[model samples]
Target: MDDFYSKQSPFNPDVKSFRFYKNGNLKIELKTKEDAEKVARLLLP
Candidate 1:
């Protein structure tokens, strides 16, 4: 998990990323409609 966050450079300015919650919730600040679709797919049961 640390390695993944490191790869994303969380300290960098304005980096788009998704956060997977422990309760299967995905948290992200979507910047485009395409991003929303991608997340929706992953969340589908």
Candidate 2:
């Protein structure tokens, strides 16, 4: 998942940072909530 995010990050300038929780959840921080939502849509099916 980290590698996937790294590869995809270049196409998403709005992404500020991303982390994977110990519980297996992904947390992505973006410039704005809308950007976060957009990233979520792209990352998810």
Best by lDDT: 2
In the predicted model 2, the residue pairs found to clash are: none
The ten-residue window of minimal lDDT in model 1 covers 1-10
User: Which digits, one per residue and each the tens of the lDDT, describe model 2 over residues 1-45?
Assistant: 443333124336787766656666676678889987876798799
Write one digit per residue (lDDT tens) for candidate 1, span 1-45: 422222222343333665655555655656677766876898896
**lDDT of predicted model 1:** 0.54
RMSD of each: 7.5, 6.6
Q: Least accurate stretch of 10 residues (summed lDDT) in model 2?
A: 2-11
Model 2 CA lDDT for position 36 = 73
